[model samples]
Target: MNYLARDPYAPKRLIEIGEAARGLGVTARTLRYYQDQGLIRSHRLARNVRGYDLAAIEQLKAIVALRAVGLPVAAIRAILVLRDQPDAQVRALRSALAEALREQQAQIQRLAALAEGMASDDAALPPAIAGLQAPSPESATPSKP
Candidate 1:
């Protein structure tokens, strides 16, 4: 039995717009958006049909992942800009990522503390109150509840 592997030469033929969009799990419109942002470049074929190289598909995947994580397109563009530089862009992206991560961690800690406080309050409440004290029609109902 033979298993098919990716064809090393498959990328030689430029992929048409639809094929390229499908490869990147995005609509052609999204690819057009990327083009507008100068994120990916394509070529025109006969009758001006758009075509992209396999490398461009890979770039689209990166763009999707970074955008999904809330990173601005500008940051992603900066990261991509370093791709052609002599030095690795890891250093530039790393500092920004680290600062953002630190802020996120602090927010998480604050949220966890608030949750713990709420849990403590729940624990301290009397069982009757915790279980919901129904009004005898003599007592007023909780305005919030």
Candidate 2:
């Protein structure tokens, strides 16, 4: 027997678009967008409706995860193109993830600074607005070693 054929994790069945989308917690339109992007493929069954094999569903799961972290479709496509080469795939994904992490970290720092500014400006506000403000996180938390 071929090594790939004996793999336990290989998909055994296919599912329709609705079932696949619900299972993955995404809309059918999202699935179509992925299809349009050539990121995933679907089968046409009965009256031109779409169906997804388990392998496609698995790919959708990964695509959903990547998109959730704000990875661009192009980057995901670049990574997927290297799927057959695990080393290349990992390298591409690592580069994309690192770049994404830097963007998120910068955004987080900016938001934190904005919040800090808002807290500082609280004192200049009218008593009504000022009173509604919670204690700054720094003041609320006990100092750590």
Candidate 3:
């Protein structure tokens, strides 16, 4: 009893905002925001209602994945366009990604250096400051009047 065979005229699945949000593990508000930002598209079902078909769902997934990797919405849009013209765009996108990676690596090195410096400073703290300790719990509490 194959369901598809039984119903030859089954309509394509049109996911509503809530269902799509749940599928993506995002809030409906976030979905709406993405829609507003023009990061993803939705089929208008009515004046205030919207739905997403399979293509739209896949596009939204791509948007989420790109955003997760720190690509800005503008960059994601450009990358999406590159999908249609890969040969023409690959070099540019690769250059941009390489630049971003270099920037991130530099930031990581700066943070590591700062952390190492702080560790050394802690090791060299003045004896008076290093020897200070919190008051014992009993001493911290006031006696009853």
Candidate 4:
């Protein structure tokens, strides 16, 4: 079978909650939690069988990413609420994502600076040991052990 030759434009298959959670890198409990919070929509398949739309999988991915970055459920809900109003919310979501990226960049820069400072001073120490040292120059001063 030439799976690589499969069409990219093919329609997405419906996924059950378990499959959706696995695809989105979350637990089935988390999916149930999102459902409880009305963050996602699902439908009943057959006797106690619940199925989710493929679009919900994408939403779950976004939700997982946002949560991974420390965004609260309420804030995530606000963004999901805007999903229905494409014209307005699309711009808002884009702006929010950009802002998040900028914040993450700033945090990375700060950590890098800290790491560089630690590496420059405290010579003759192992990298792992040096990393625990305070990043500030004051901390590098000799003192009673």
Which candidate wins on TM-score? 2
C-alpha lDDT values of all predictions: 0.69, 0.79, 0.68, 0.69
Report RMSD (Å) for each prediction in the order shown: 12.7, 12.1, 12.2, 12.2
Provide the lDDT at 136 for model 4.
89
Extract clashing residue pairs from model 3: none
Cα deviation at 12, candidate 1, in Å, is 5.0
Please provide, for model 2 over 81-137, each residue's C-alpha lDDT reduced to its tens digit, 9 standing for 90 to 100.
998999999999999999999999999998886667668643464455667867787
TM-scores for candidates 1 onward, in order:
0.56, 0.72, 0.63, 0.56
Which residue segments of model 3 deviate by more than 4 Å?
1-11, 121-145
Kindly list the per-residue Cα lDDT of model 3 for residues 15-96, writing each as its tens digit. 7777888998877777787778777776654344567778888988977776665566677667767777887567656765
| Candidate 1 vs candidate 3, lDDT winner | 1
- Better model by TM-score: candidate 1 vs candidate 3: 3
TM-score of 1: 0.56
lDDT tens digits by residue: candidate 4, 1-145? 1112122443345566777778777777888888888888666544554567667777888888887875657767877788779877777666667777788899999888767766866546556665785558855765210
How far is 112's C-alpha from truth in model 3 (Å)?
A: 0.9
Candidate 4: pairs in clash: none
- Kindly report which residue stretches of model 2 are placed more than 4 angstroms away from their true locations once superposed: 1-12, 121-145
Candidate 4, RMSD to the unseen true structure = 12.2
Q: Is candidate 3 or candidate 4 better by TM-score?
A: 3
Candidate 2 C-alpha error for residue 41, in Å:
0.9
Model 3: weakest 10-residue lDDT segment is 1-10
